[model samples]
Structures are given as structure tokens and as C-alpha cells.
Target: MKSNQTYAITLVEYAYGPAFSNAMVYSGYYEMTGTTAVEYVIGVIEGPSGILLVDCGYDPQHEVAGRESRAQNHIKYQHPTKVLKKAGFNPEDVSGILLTHLHWDHADCLECFPNAKIYVQKDELFGWIETLSMPKEYNTLKVSVDICDIKECINALGEDRLVLLDGSVEDLFPGIDITVAPNGHSWAGSLITVNTKDGKYTFTGDTAYVKDNILGGRHDGVSMPNGYNCGSVKNVLITMQDILRLAQGDMNKVLISHDIGVWDCFESITTPEDDLRIAYVAK
Candidate 1:
């Protein structure tokens, strides 16, 4: 049986990255002029156990190799600790951290939370290891990943702070379950579902970048795949069907971490001093 408890989830924006080209966001969107600014966020899940985070924002001080250089307009608004405080919690208060994938933007800041146990998909790590083992000519396959970050995750495992799930998990923590979209966005993208007072809200971290990928393609009764990914497009569409099933065709119930439109669609609070915004997923 699944846990009946509910949690309050909030999304905290820590920084804003470079604008994403349309082709990079929407599959088959070949237009070059159209672009959209994306928000880098961390999902805060508060429940009976304590505060848990969906993905920790990256560390600006140590820019990892292979990551695209931040442009002049790229903003590092606030450190994760300060931003979390502005959002009403301390870094130390985070009891667990759920990583959607090991991309630099998502998993590089795990060290910030001293007391939290980190959870990641087992295959996500192995897939990167396999990529890293490939020949030099295949380097493009891992441009978005940071070897240092992967090493840090391995170190956490050695220290007993990391839990690698083989596949989808139920009641990972009370009211919080995890579902994987393997070979979709990354090696294994973990889509999180948190039960709330109103209903269940699913946090999609790169699995579905925008509304169209999950909600569009309705005429064909299938999902639209993102243009940018590290895996097969066919598998991406297949994985999206799982996300769509979880959402039950309701776009409002899906929380897309990278989409700025989420802020417009939900009740949000912005702290100018910290230069961060919090979108309430469930009150």
C-alpha cells in the first residue's frame, strides 16, 4: 500500500540560464530566431519527515568542464543556502535530496546539504560512466555533464549518503514517490509525484521541458518529444507517454522545472533581495 500522507511542495528559482533556442526545446522546431529564457529551480518538498529537495541548484563558484560557458547575461542570483532560507528553510533542515538526473545543473550542489541523503537512479550513473569511457571523438555525448560532479556522487556513495534506485519506487518517503523515464531526457530521468491536500502534483525535471512535450501532440494521441536530449527520440516519446499517464492529460498538475511559464500558471512569491522566486505547487 502507498502512504496516505500529503506534502507541500514549493519551487525555488536560484538562477536564470541562457535563453534556449526553439529548436533546442521543441522537437522539429527548426526556427532559429525564436528563443525562451529558462529558469533553474529546486523543488522543496515539506512533509512529516522534514524538508526534502527535488534537485539542488549548481555551484557557481566552481564551473565544471564540458558545461557551456555562462553568457554575459547569465545570472547567479543566490547561493542555494541563502535562497533556501529566503524560501523559509535552512540547508541543514533538508533531510533528503532527490536528483532528477546527474546533469551539472541538477546534481552539482549536493554537498551544500550536509545532512541529507541523496537519491539517484542507478542507471543514470552507469550510463554516464559508460559515456565517459568512450573514445575522445565521442566527447560531445557528455558536454552537459561534469565528471567532477559524478565523482562527488560516487564519493557520497562511499560515505553512505547516496541511495541509487534501480527503477521506479513507491513511497520513497511518505507521500513522495519516484518514477523513471529511462533514456528519455537523460539516462534515467526521475519524475517525482507528491501527494498534496488538493491532489497529486508531479515534478518533471527535464523529462518534459515545456507544456507542448507533455500536453501537445494531442491530435495524434501521443507526446511531443523535446528537441534536445541524450537518448533516443523514440524512447523519449515513449517515456513521455508515462508522464502523460501520470498527469492524466491535465497540464496544470505537471511542474516543469525549466519552464518560466510555470511561474505564470501558479501562485508565486518573489524575493527581490535574494533575486529568487518560489512557486507554490501545493499549499
Candidate 2:
């Protein structure tokens, strides 16, 4: 794949926003709680020709901290500033954004990348408003960062920046593809497939909290919202079926947006000098 093109991938740390107490740990999600750790990250895909972000990490201020903060949108916005500087770039230097669902953590700071084009699942964007009422779409009150609500996106981005693509996707870039999985955590949930040196990596934004959920076959349309469960049992069934196909083991490797372990698949370098020798990132 390196021979196919010259590019770099950056996994910048953002907010570390979750609070895990006893009950959470007792329930087997000890990692989701306590002072152990929290992480919010966004993936930067850079080819010799372009710069694209996997998702927009959240805004960490208290005002946006309510439910949006539940997943612990782990962040250190300074991570962006620092990573960019070390890479000889800046926030404004980003040229494109591929929003993975509109949850605040993944969509809040889009304004920072004013010069980019934002790509998303077309159905996911429209579904945000219409699907909340559908049992299959699940309650999106918390996940809905619909294009219209952000106001900033509307005011600064205009509709062009928000291109919604639904269903199976073609080559999004030289080696990447966008496949919107309609399993119910949110209306237009998308799973991003990136063709990397190691293999194909699929980034699932909240489709599941941990890779096990996907391994457990959760995307079959029966997906339960993280920290909330508005999904229909019916949705879970279909999503599970979808995972079965992917799990076949060559098509892709699933990376959950909230999974701390899966992050290891990517290598993290403190400076640009570390360069693009690996496929994934980690803390």
C-alpha cells in the first residue's frame, strides 16, 4: 500500500471524558470508569494529495459536557495543536473531514477545519432527525449532531461541506471506502474502511464501545446505544448478520471509536519525525 501512494496517518488525542465508579467496574467495564484512564481521538489520513480526518473530536468545555460527555469523549484539544505543529501543520491546515456519525465528540470542533470538505453517510445525516421516532433508528436525542443543529456548520460550512453518502460506497480515496452501516445506534451510523499498509482497517464510530461488541456480533441492527439503549431487538438481529460477514477475516479489521484496546493497532509518534511507518495509533 505504501507503494500505492505516500501518506501519513495521525491519531491525535482529544478529551479523556469518562467517569467510572464501582458499579461500572463490577459490571466488567472497569476500564470505562475510575481514574485508570480515558481517551478521545481523531484519525488524520494524509495522502501525498490530500488531508482527511476520520472524525472531529469533541469540544471539552463544561457547556458541552452533559450527555455528550458520557462516552468520555477523551480529549486534549492541545493534542491537535501539538500534533499539527510537530507535523509542520495546524488545525486550519486540515483540508477534509470524514465525520463518523454526528455525535458531538465526533462532530463538535469541525469549525476548526474551515478549509475542508466534510464527508458523511447521507442517510446518517438525514436520519438523525427522522429516525429518532423510528424504533429501528433508536433515540438519538444524545447522538444527533444533525447538520442544522450545529449552526456553525450551517453558517461557516454551507451545504457543500456536508456531503452525505448513503449505502455502499465506492473508493473514497485511492485506498479508502465508506460503508454506512444502518445498525441502530444512531440513524446514519457509518463504518469507515481504510486501506493501509498492514491491511484494511474499519473505524466504527460508536457502533460498539469495545471491539468485543463487534466480535459479539452487535452491529446486526440490534445495537444498543452506548450509555443508553434505545435500539430495537429487531435492529440488533440485522446488525449481527452484517458483522458475521465482516468477521470472515479478510475484508476488514473493526476499530471501535470508543475501544481503548483496538487503538493499539495504530502506532503513535510524538513528532512528525516518527513518520508514516505504521497503520494505526495509540497512547
Candidate 3:
């Protein structure tokens, strides 16, 4: 079924930093050396329904405190609102936010859009809640999540602004649909596909970090999984295969939110102040 509406998609780069090569690809240390520059991004979809965000970028206000960090070198951080405003869009007018997953980097900034309804996989929420409840020895499992973000979701639930999905949903909004890949990158990772004026583009959250994960970089014809997986590596493979199938074998149609290479594939404009970018995927 096709929606009567089509959107103009934009990829917003709010922050960036160096990421370990191995963190991007499983056992990448063997063949990959040095850190690769990566960006933290969010997807912006504009259509007749309203301005919708794929995933909210991380919140600077809650940066991991008092810790010597390895991946904490992220810079040029800007709230989605400020970034959107600098790019000539009204941040306050956001109507909804489709959370691909609840990793702190993706969902911590939800408070920025107070009036927007949040759509997330119910299993994603439940999975995190269950994991967070485990003993401190299981802390490794909780590394990528923020308790505050979960609290914020709970608050949204109380405010009637959270829409939890049991699984996948088509036409969540006109020209927009959500696909949940249970136990993929994170505990219940998911991706959103936008049928836009140009074509259908899939905004893959953290499920597939670099093209190598989907396009087979390890060997001539094999897809490699990212290094970190809160779920299982086997599930990661399944999710990526599903992503490739959804893209219909066209790697160009899949937008890897963290990959720096995305800017090269699309026409992107950088904001003057923060040096953030907005890539027009469809317009």
C-alpha cells in the first residue's frame, strides 16, 4: 500500500568524533588500523503530516561524567533544535520522533521536542528496562544505555506522548514505515524507511554502522558485523541481511546514520556556526 504523501528527507549531523576501527567492524583490528572519523546524526522527514525526526541525537547535558573515556572525544556537539534552526527549519514545530533505538546517543535528546509524540518498539523499551534491572556485574550489558533516557521515556509515557509498537508498522505516518529487528545492534534495534519524492530511503540506526556491514567489506562476498552488539552477533547478521533486502540490493538507498561516508553519497550543506551538516536525501 502506498501513502498519499511523500516526504523530503534530510540527514542532520549534530556531532562527530573518532571511532575505533574495530568498533565499526567485528575483529577489524586484524586488517583495519587507526581510528575512523564518524558523525552522530538524526534523520529529518518533512511532509504534509509535519516535521518528523528519525532519532534524536545525544544530549550534551548528560555526557558521561567523571570518567576517562576512549570514545568520548566526540566534538561539534549541537542540539537538534539549534542545528535545525541554523539550517532554516523551525525546531519547535516537530510533530513526532521515531526512535530507531534507545541507545543514549540516539534517544537521550527527546526532551528537546516536548510536544512531539515518540514512536518506539515496545520490545526495545522492555528489553532495556529488563537489562538495566540486572545486577551490577552485568554492567557491561548496560554500557550503551542511559537510565535517565529510560526515565524520560517513562515520563513521556505518563504524558501520553509515547507510542510503543509491538513490532513493525507500516504507514506509521504517510510515506513512513518502521521495521524492528529484534536483538540486532542493541536490544530490539530498528530502522525506519521513508518513501520520499526521490525514492525509498532506509534510515538505518546503529544496526549497520558502515557500508562494510551491509556491502561485505571483510571478504569479497561476506557481510561483517560491527564489533559491539548488546544482543548477539548472529542477530546482527540477520538484521543487516534484512536491511539489504529492504534497500532492494541498492546500497545507495541505505543511509547509515554514523558513517562519515554518507556525506559523500548525497548533496550535503554544513551549518556555518557548528559546522554540522544536513544532507538532502530526497527533495
State TM-scores per candidate: 0.92, 0.71, 0.93
Off-target runs (Cα >4 Å) in candidate 2 are 1-7, 18-38, 66-89, 130-140, 143-149, 156-159, 217-225, 229-252, 269-283
Higher-scoring candidate on TM-score, 2 or 3: 3
Comparing 2 and 3 on lDDT, the stronger one: 3
- Predictions in order: lDDT: 0.80, 0.55, 0.80
Q: How many clashing residue pairs are found in candidate 2?
A: 28
Inter-residue clash pairs, candidate 1: none
lDDT at residue 252 of model 1 (Cα atoms): 83
- What is residue 137's positional error in candidate 2, in angstroms? 17
Which run of 10 residues does model 3 get worst, by summed lDDT? 63-72
Ranking according to TM-score, highest score first: 3, 1, 2
Indicate the residue-level lDDT of 127 in model 1. Answer: 94
**Model 3 CA deviation exceeding 4 Å by range:** 27-32, 63-70
Candidate 2 scores a C-alpha RMSD against the true structure in Å of: 6.2
lDDT of 3 by residue, 96-177 (tens): 9899898877888888888889888999999999999999999988877888889989999999999998888888887788
lDDT of 1: 0.80
Each candidate: RMSD: 2.2, 6.2, 2.1
- Stretches of candidate 1 above 4 Å error? 65-73, 217-222
